[model samples]
Target: MVKHGISLVEAARRLGVSQSTLYIALQKGQIPTFRRDGRTVVSSGALRDYQTGKRPPCAYRL
Candidate 1:
């Protein structure tokens, strides 16, 4: 059974990225996540928004 939210591995697979890459994205705040039951969770809406380009990638202003 699928959980309320998706695991980082699943999200990475859907995004065609590696788990570590997703982890880095999480750490860098490129992708949003929240804690649920002591595990990091990403919402489907957020994933969809990312896929559809509704959310921009993290940019560093120097």
Candidate 2:
């Protein structure tokens, strides 16, 4: 079955950013996340929105 969400690490890789950078974004709420099986994951659609500049601009630069 295809996964609907991706791990933070995988998300970082797909975004071409470091995990620390992704964590920073998470902290700032720039990226949305959800708990799945006690682990944090981001939905594919959300990631796509972020990549497409659909998310609001972050106050802190990444």
Q: Which predicted model would earn the best TM-score?
A: 2
Q: Deviation in angstroms for 61 in model 1? A: 7.9
Tell me the spans in candidate 2 whose CA falls farther than 4 Å from its real position.
1-3, 56-62
RMSD of 1: 4.0
**Range of the 10 consecutive residues with the lowest summed lDDT in candidate 1:** 53-62
lDDT of 1 by residue, 1-62 (tens): 45588888899999999898777767766677877799999988788887887765666321
Please list the Cα RMSD from the true structure of every candidate, rounded to 1 decimal place: 4.0, 3.5
Model 1: colliding residue pairs: none
- What is the TM-score (0 to 1) of candidate 2? 0.79
Instruction: Name the regions of candidate 1 deviating beyond 4 angstroms.
Output: 1-3, 56-62
Overall lDDT per candidate, in order of appearance: 0.79, 0.85
Assess the local accuracy of residue 29 in candidate 2 as a C-alpha lDDT between 0 and 100.
74
lDDT of 2 at 26: 84
Across residues 1-62, which tens digit of lDDT does each residue of candidate 2 receive? 55568999999999999999889888877888888888899998878888897885667664
For model 2 the local lDDT of residue 41 reads 96
